[model samples]
Every structure is written in C-alpha cells, then in structure tokens.
Target: MTNPLLYWLWLAERPGCSAKLAHRLLHAFGSPEAIWRADREQLAAADSLSRAKLDALADKDLTYARRIADDCARLHIDIVTADAEQYPRQLLDLSDAPLVLYVRGTLPDFEEQLTISVVGTRRATPYGLRAARYFAGNLAQRGCIIVSGMARGIDGEAHRAALEAGNVTVAVLGCGVDVCYPWQHEQLMQRIIRQGAVISEYPPGTEPAARHFPARNRIITGLSRGTLVVEAPKKSGAMISADLALEQGRDVFAVPGDINRPNSAGCNACIREGGAALVQTPGDILACYAHPRQPGAPRARKPDVRQEEQLHLDSPEVFAAAPRTMRTLEGGEPERTVWQAVHSGRHTVDEIVNETALPASDVLTALTILEVGGYVLRVGEGFCAADDVQLPQQTNEEPNLG
Candidate 1:
C-alpha cells in the first residue's frame, strides 16, 4: 500500500482521468487509500474508467507521486484533499469543487473569517481601477479577507489595496500555485502569499491556458460569501465569475459604470438584468454579510477626489458641476461638433446623435478625443462637461463611496 498523502496525489494526477471521474472513483471506493488498493476488476466495475485507464492505474508505480510529495515538503506547499480537516468548508459545498487544492501559503479560517471576491476585466478603465481600490481598501480595513484571481487591472489593484491597507488578501491562480502566469506579477504574488495565500487545483508545473481561467474563476467565488464585479466587458472572464457566483447561490455586486464605456458595459448589464445588486461603497457590500462587524475595525481614510468625480449616482450631483471644463476643440470638425452637443446638454450617445445628426460611430470617436483632453467626464449614463467640476473638499471624516 502507498502512503495516504501519495494516494491522494495519485488520484488527482492519474492519466486520462478527469476531475469528475476522479471524484466519482473517490465516492465509489470510500477513500484514496481504498482506491489505490482496488484491483483492476473493481476499478472497471466503477463503470467510468476505460479498460486502458484501468490497466495504467493498476500497473502504475508510486515513484512519481513520492517525488511530488517530497517536492511539496521542500517547497512548503500544503496539499488539501476533500476529506482533509483543513480543507475549506466553503469549497466542499460546491458541486464542481477541485479534488485537491495546492496551497503555497497559510489558509485563512473561512468558517470564522469574512471573505469576499472582487473580480473584473484585465483591461480596466481608470474609473474602474479607482473603484476597486476604494472598495477593497475599505473592506480590508473592516477585517474582511479579500479574494481575487490576481490578474492585471482590477484584480491586481484590489489585492494591492487590501495589503496596503494592512490586511490580508488571497490570490487564487488559474495556473499552478508555484507558477505566476502574468510574469510581471511575480513580486505581487509573493506579497500575497506572505499576507494570505496563493492556491490552485493544478499541479506545480502546469501553465495557465485559456480554458483554465473559467475553472479558476469558480474557485474564486466558491471561496467567498459574495462576488463583486468591479468592471468587465459584456463578454469577459469576470462575467463568467459572476455567473458562477449565481449558480452557487452567492450574492453578486456590481459597481455601476458609464453606459458608453465598453469595459463597464457588462457591470451595468448585470445590474439591469437583476443578476447583481448595485454597490456604491464598501459598506454596501459589508452590509450583506450575515456576521456582525468585528470590534476594532481599522480607522478609515479620506476618499480619493478622483473617485468622487466618477461616481455620481445621486441625481443632484450628476449635473451639479457647471460646464466649466468645456473648451473649444482646436483639433478637428468632429471634436468641435461632439463638444457642442455635450455642452448643449445632449449628454447620452443617443441624444448626441440626435442633436448632432451624426452617425453613432463618429460621435463616439469625437467623444473619446474630447475625453482625453480633460474636456469631458462620464457621469452615470451621460457625459458631463468637466469645466465647472470642483474637487470635493477634503474632510477629516472617513470616506464613503456614495
């Protein structure tokens, strides 16, 4: 008989065996130890393993599994199986949960800790980035354990914000726990492991592929009480994460974004379709937790002025700033025309099209140019002239996104 830990590793790494099939075998046999001891006839009787697979399993040696166990010991990686006492309670309830999890750092006590997932598009806009930092920082200060994929843009921003706020954050990877996919984030990954953990279902050498991301996303939401979409396109990995959150009976929250921005389109759509609740501040998300606030929450800091300009959910503030940022476009006829429409209060794309009597594409192109010049700012679903916009006066009070 092989070592118990080796058997578990072997069950997950068996050739041609899918995670689903491995899980079925575990259920049929009672344990990895029992499965390892089962004869070929019994293995075949499970009805899922092919004849060739049965032969391979029956004839295979434990040499490789032994090596892997040794490597993990030397690397300080923890192998958590479904039956392990240290396995996350939240993941066990998931239907498609991984058979085993490879963890490179200390795992938090999910049963006692408040965990939330923050996800978004890799190509996050400046507005989306600010929102991610604001919410994540505030939530971390309140003792929440932030979870994310550690991808670029919003994911990276959220993790950094949490750590910067003197709290912990978990980074669940699409690749191996040892392999950092976005090479540039190697340092950030180390920072995360120190503060929280880096975990994955794949073995230590597996590279991140396109197909691995959706599978990875499931774990992100599975580990949390709720999932937050900071920003995402209509068709993106973040939307897939949101769908998984719904499937798992978890709450979904989306930070509202401008309707005209492609990166924000999915978030707005999620809100409109009633798939997620709109969140303006970290407190809104914190309210969803069933647990009471932990005593001694960290002191809050002043909100960034740039974030306030972009989040104009209240009707009074949406158009409160006078059109003081407006300026004559010296560049092209299209820029001047689009500026005129926005300055004239034809803010929405449809309104601009109607007022300018120009094609939607032309209007959008002109708006982009004007926006780059600091002449326009997005407010809700409309465009606002930035001329009269005043930076909010700094206050000693703690910042709130609303």
Candidate 2:
C-alpha cells in the first residue's frame, strides 16, 4: 500500500486539482487515500473535477511528489497538510485554504497565540516605515506573533522589528519555502527562521509568480487575528490583504498617514469608507484583542518598553509653533494664517477661505499640507485641530524626505 501522506502530495500536485476541487474531493471521499483509490467513474460523480483532471490524477506518477517530500527532508523543512494537527486553525476558516504548508521553521500554536499581520507597499515612506516598526515592536513585546508577506519595505521592517524585540514573527512567502524571492532578504530570512518561521503553500523549488501573490495574501490574513496596513497606495496588494482579512472576520487596522502622501492614500480611504480602524499607536491595536488569550498563553502584565511622551496631532501648541524652515508647506505665512482660522472656529473650506481672505487654491493647499503635517484633523463635515492624534514619543530626528 502507498503511504497515505504520499497520496496527499500526489493529489495536491496533480494538474488542474485546484485547492477548492481538492477540498471537495476530500470531503466526498473521506481522505486522500480514498480519493486516490476511487476509479474515474466515482470521481466524475463528485462533479467538481473535469474529465481531463480526473484522468490526469489517475495517471500521474508519484515520483515528483516523492521528490518534493524528499527535498523538504533534506533541507530540514516540514510539510504540514491541512489535516495535520499542527495546521493553523485560523486557516481552516478560509474557504480556499491551502491543502499543505511547506514550513522551514517551527509552527506556532496559532489558536493559542495572538497573531497580527503587518502589510504595506514596497515603496514605503519614512512615516510608513516608522509606523510599521513601532506597531510591530510594541505588539511583539506584548506577545503577539507578527505575520507578514516577507516582502520589502513595510513587511521587512515589521518582521525585523518584531525579531529585534525578541518576539516571534512569521513570514508567509509568495514563493516556495526554500526559495527567497527578493534575494536581498536572504540574511533576513535566516534571522526569521532562527526566531520564528517561514511558511508557504507552494512546494519547494516553485518560483514566485504574479498569480501566487494574491493567493499568498489569503494565507497571511488567514493566519492572523488581525491585519494592519501601515502604508499603501489607493490600489495595491496591501489593500487586498485588508479586504481578505475583513472577509475572514479579522480586525483591520490602518496606520493614519499624511493626507498629501500618496503612500497613505489607500489607508486613509479605508478609514473613510469605515472598512478599517485608524491606528495611531500599538495600544489601538492591543485593544482589538478583547477576547481572552489562549488558556495556557500568558499575557504580558508589565509594559515591555518605557512609556514614551505622547503627542496628539491636534495639540494647540504644536499647531501654534510656526516652523522657521518648513519645506512641505508653500510658505510660513499661508500655513500659520490658515491654522489660526481653523483654530478660531472657521471649519469648512469655504468658511476658512472666507475668513482667511486667502485664495481658494491656497486654502486647499495649506489644508493638505497641514493635514499631512499632522497639524489638522478632518472631522465629519469640518476641520479641527488634530488634538486626538496620538503618536509615539520622539527619540531620533525625523527623516527629511524632501
């Protein structure tokens, strides 16, 4: 008799046997062994597989499948099927969950762990990079396992920060578990394997493909209790992850960014559409896990890092200070004059334009600069001093992107 696990690998590798179709076959036949033993007539009766696929499954040799399993063992990788006890329970909730995960490091008890995915675009701004690090570090210190796509920019920053805090971080890859796509992240991948895990549904030696990424996203969001978008454009893979998380009933958090920055537009849109919560600090994310932790998992009672000075965007003093060398704004006079108008109870664009006596374009430009600079907040129907915006304390000089 063939090894039951080998049958699973063969069935999974069979051409045209999509994840959904494989699942249907499993549900109908009880197990991979049963599915393999069934004749073409029985499979056709299942109605989900095409005749060509059924023939392909019936005729394919297990040589390549066996080679994949052997390669995993040679490289110290583990093949975890959906039916395995080590499989993450969160993934079971996904309708199109992968049948197996090629794991290069230890798999955590996702049911017993607090997991959150941090995702964003490759072209992240300094603001987005900092936000990713701050949130990932604070959450990791508090015992939440950070999950990400292991891509460049935000994802890499989040994983590195989490590991730096001596916490577990899982990287769900778009390629095979053994292959590193970015190549620059080879060293980073090693660090993660030492401290956390690198997992993928694609078998070893599989190259990263365009189609694999969106499918890769479901697993990232699927494994976590929540997904955080640190920065993204109006349309990007990060938003897809956010959408997938929401569909999976996972909490979605978007770090507020400058309104004028294109990198932040997607996050801002998500907030405006009521699709995600505005995340100002790690505390905002921590609050989402209101449910009790896993029975055996210990929650960190003491703060991991010293509480830093908090700054709200709407602080009157902050808005009052006229920066002598501000470059993001057109001129000091326009910004200060506009700030005073809003501070003095002029709310709407028309109202501020009327009161400041400045041209409509100038008011609009200043408002964009002010909001981006974190000096003003867009409340419902009106603008206000950004007094409620909370940001982590300052230590290093702010990056000069200009």
Candidate 3:
C-alpha cells in the first residue's frame, strides 16, 4: 500500500511524469507493494515503462517512498486506491482518473447522489458573487451540497452561502488539504473543515501553483452531477472547468450575462455554443435532482401574480401551477435571475441580494416568473436587463438576487 504507487506519485510530483504512467504501472504490477518488490530486470521488462521512470525506479526513489509512508502513518489519512467501494464513482467515469485519492474527512455519497459543481472567475462582480451565494444557499436548502475551488469570489461565496444555510459544502483545494491559499479565505477554510471537507491530491504540505488549478478544476466538476458557471471572462479558469465538466459527461449550466460586459464572454459563449444550459434559478437545478429537498413550498409565496405566471409557463396539462407571487408584474413576473436581475441597468445577483437581502431561492422563484412574462433577457453571466421594453416594477416585486 505504501511503496511503488506512492513513490511514483511522489515522482509524479517531480515535474513531468504523467498520471497515465502511474496508471500503466498500476495495471501491470497489480499493486504498489508488488511493483516495489520487482527486480531491475523485471522493472526493465515491463512494457511502456518510460526509460526516465524505470531508471529512477531503483533505490533512488526509495527514500521518498519511505518518507511518504511515514507521513501517511503520522496523519492517519486514508488512501482510497482505485476501484474501491470508498472510491468516488464520479471520478471513475473519467478516462484518466487519479490512481489514488487522499481524503481527510468523511466522503459524501457520490454513488447515490449527484453533486453540482459551481465555478466562476476569481475577480467576480457584485452580481457574480450574489448569484453564487443565492444558488449555493438555495441549492443547499434543496439538499444539494455545493462544490467549488474555494477561490476568492464565486467559489468562496458558494461555500459560505451553503454553510450559512446549515448545510455542507466541499472545497477541492489546489494545495494540500491542510494548507490555505490566497490567505484571505483562511478563516473560511477553517469553517469548511468543521462543517464539510477540504480535499486535494497533493501531499500534505504542498503549496498551490498556476498549473495545479486546472487539474484541480477537473476534480471539482468531475466529482459532481453537474457544473454551473456563474461569471467568467473570455479567458477565465471557469471556462476550463466547464470544458472538463462536459468531457466528464456532467451537465453544464451557465448563467447568461451582458454581451457588452467584458467579464461575461465565457458564459455567453457557453450558452450560445450549447455547451451549457441557461440556468435562470435554483428551481431549474433542483428540479433535475432525484429527490429535491424543499421543492419550493407553495405556501411561502403570495397567491395572485405568482400563480398566474405559473399559468403562463405551465403546460396545458397543469393549467395553473399554483397561485404564487409572480403574476403581479405588469410585463411579467421576475421568474428567474435572467429576468429578475435586470433592472434600469444590468444587475448581477449580488446587487439584487444585497439590496433586497432575500435568499437566492426566493429570488430564483421570482426570476422564473418574470422570465415567463418576457419582461427581461439573460444577457450573460447572471446579468439581466429590460428586453427592449422595460416593465415597470409592479405590485409583484422581484426579490433582490442576493
């Protein structure tokens, strides 16, 4: 358990040895202990084993192997080798999944559950932040544990909002689970370790680098049922995660943003190219879950306009979904963030949330209503605006997109 595989992974840490080589070794050797016991001729005879790797396989790499063994012993961390019941099934679906996963806390129910990965740019706008919070908060209430990188803007917002809702959130850190990057979110990291979990593939003391984040992004989207991109520039880390999510057979949801806004390009492109679904609110996501938590109780909303808007979007079968708060807006109800977040100027979910201080779930409900009425348009990355016709803020006021 603590020999060749650990050493190879440690050598994998040394720059250019690919995880593919690690996999090949796992396949041929059967186990780390077996690979370590193999003589030099036996090592040389192994097919597809790179010369650089084979040469370093002798006593040279033994010390590092022993040290990692000692480190794991001291930390009491369990290593989930590939194909175990404890291994994350979501990862198995990927073609090049990691050979071993080092987990520090209780793993979530990946086999029976569908985790949603929400990611976005680090330099997020107020709207991006608010949208992340609202989505995380509402998703948590709906019994969905949010997954993010724990970077400053959208990622941090998602984790914090989930925690605030008295739920768990998983942070897939680029560095070691015990380390915190950017320093600003250190306090938040502690909270996550207490309420949820922080995980990484890097050894316990590794620091983060630009290269680590892309691989880290893969884990964030790979381990979940889906991925949501809230806000991103044309060149953003969020887009990379979105790409990986698609490659992993996970659903991709991108919040639309303003075309004129430079920060929204990635999300807008995703929506246009059909790489992602245009997610207007949390309801849209929860509906995808097998057994949604709250299911948005009807009693919480007002009867008139909300109910009528439901009628507008309703299939002929249902007739009227229910008497909810959305029916009151003149042009339509604020049914989803696509419609609700748009005001005199384009607004982000954060602006809406801070001004209204409403939970994102309620905001999602309102946005759905307005979107049905055609009063607003989802321009890009949670940005919404009057759709050529500004509907007056009606008696059915939209909740702020906090």
Candidate 4:
C-alpha cells in the first residue's frame, strides 16, 4: 500500500504552488491522492492553476518527498496532513492554510483549549521580557497553551515561562521541526519538544530563511484563539502576526507600553488605531473570551470607547477601592519567602532569587502564585507588594534563607 502522506508531501512540495493554489486544487480534486492521479486535462480543469503550477504539479517526482518522509521517520517527526484528525481545526479556517504540518512532540488539542500566541521583537527590552513572562506564565497556569516562535528575547521568554509554569507551549517555527534556526535556542527548542511541540509547515530538513517567517506568522496566529503582542516596533514580525490574527478573525490583544519607547510603537499604534484591545493583565484577555459568541456573530474587534467607559463605570469599586488583596498568603514556605522579598523591596525576580536564596524556578512559581493572589503586583519589569496587603509580623532575627 502506498503511504497516504506521500501524496500530501507531493502536493505541498510542488514548486511554485502557493497555499491558495493548493487549496483551490483541493477544492477541485477533493483530496491529495485524487489530485496526484489526475491527468493534465483534469488538472487544467481545476480553476486558477496557471501553466507553471500545472506543469509543476505534473512533474510527479516524489523522490525529495520520499526522502523527507524518511528523514521524519529517522528523526521522529510526525507529518500531520490537513485531513488528519489531529490537525488543528483552527487552521482549516484559513483560505491559505498549509496542506501539511511537520511536528515534533505532542500537538495539544487546540480545539478544546485556549491557545494564545505571544509574539514580539527579538531584541526585547527588560519591560517586554518581564511582561511576556508575566502574561504567558499566568495564562499557562490558567490552562491556556502558550504559543510562540521560540526566537530570542520575547518569544524565548514566553516559552520559558510557560515551561516554568509546567504547562504546554507550542513553538511555530519558520524552519523545519528537525532544524533549529537560531542555534542559540537549541536547548529551548529541545525543551519545547519534550514538554509541548515544535511545528512547521516546512518539511523536515528545510532551513530557515528570511522569506519563511511572514508565512510562519500566519500559522502561529491561525493555531491560536488570540494573539498578544507584548512589544513590537512599527514594522516588526510581531505586528505582522497581530495583523494576521485580525485577518484570521482572531482576537488581538496588546500590552500597553510606554509611549516614548521605540519598541512600543507598534502596540501603541495598534491600540490607538483601534486594531487591538489594550490588555492590562491576563484577566483582560480572559474576559473577552469568557463566553462563546453566537453563531455567525462577530468576534472581538476594535474596542468601543463608550462601552469601555461604561464598563469602568459599572465596576467603579474595582478602581475606587484600595489595592486588591487576599485575606492571607495561604501558600507554604516558598510563597512566604518570595512575598517577603517583594514586600521588602526586592523588586525583580533576580533580586528576589538572590535575596531569598531560592532557586529561580521556585521564585518564579511563587511569584506567579503571589501575583494571582493579589499580594504582589507586576510593576514595570519588577514586582511590588500590593498596597493594603498585610504581611505576617517578623522577628528581629533574620528569616530563614533556605
């Protein structure tokens, strides 16, 4: 019996075949297998296939595709075709969705869970990195699968935080799943594969190129319920992802940043132009998707100033009251140590880890808990104790640093 994936690989790897054209062909022929067996006249009958695409489809050379299948088997990569049950239904909504996806590790059930793409500049600032960590980590703890590119800076921080939160994260790579583009992220890539997945539309052994990323951004946003831009310049790839998310009819959320910063320009523009909703916290994003929309109803779009003001007015107590606080720090030793450090002015995670002499992972976990419980607030790149939250009395003796 012929490998069914061979037909998919052939359709995907055909020279000059764009996703739109492939989709058109799929619509005409119904399946890759049927398209592969179709004659020249049959292929010509398909709409929008130019002479070059038809000739490319006629070449019928499966040698390269066979080699890719071999490479996937040898490297333990899974090739998910568009028709596969495991293929994300979210991507199918796109008119130009990839015909195949190469995956390493388990692909989460994206249809059943909330998946948010966290994207931003590769050269991220301290504020961007911290915001990425805070939002991605907290969202992951809320059972949202974090999706990112696994690039340097913001993307890497998002993936790492999700992993640190002990939740799944999907990295949509421009390069092949078998190849790591930015050699620096080899360790991070490996961790994602072990814990979640690293996926690409490119077949195994395809190297990363500048042109691949714009297409890669579509997959990133397509696989998620929403996209969050932590920070971006006016013309960065993250902005492209946000635009693509909007085009895909997915919710676009951006963390508001300082107006003076160059890296923040895109996010500011997105919010100012009413292209994205301003996200102050993970809760803000969560609230938009809390209830399912009615069939054929519009997705979340540009926020209405009047409705926003009304919302704020309706919840005046939320802003009028003292800083929100939990009754007590109910967590055990790590939480207490981390909270004490933050309350005592150890603002950054590095400072808390150093001052408390706790492992970075423990410090981060504690910080997420404390932030969620309203004992600590994420202020800029660091943290601060929430006002009006009372702490247990301490003795003159130094607290245990263990």
Q: What total of clashing residue pairs does each candidate reach?
A: 5, 3, 33, 0
Each candidate's TM vs. the true structure?
Answer: 0.73, 0.74, 0.68, 0.76
Q: lDDT of all predictions, in order shown? A: 0.79, 0.80, 0.68, 0.85
Model 1 spans > 4 angstroms off: 51-56, 290-402
Tens digit per residue, CA lDDT, model 4, 226-268 = 9999999999999999999999999899988778778899999
lDDT of 1 by residue, 45-119 (tens): 985677778976785578878887887787788998888898998987786678889998789888777888999
Clashing pairs in 2: 313-386, 314-386, 314-387
Q: Ten-residue segment with the worst summed lDDT in candidate 3? A: 312-321
Give me the candidate number with maximum TM-score: 4
* Candidate 3, superposed: residue stretches over 4 Å from native: 1-15, 39-45, 72-78, 290-402
| Number of residue pairs clashing in candidate 3, backbone atoms closer than 3 angstroms, sequence gap of 3 or more or interchain | 33
Residue by residue across 235-265, what tens digits does model 3's lDDT show?
8899999988887767788878778766689
Q: Of the pair 2 and 3, which is ahead by lDDT? A: 2
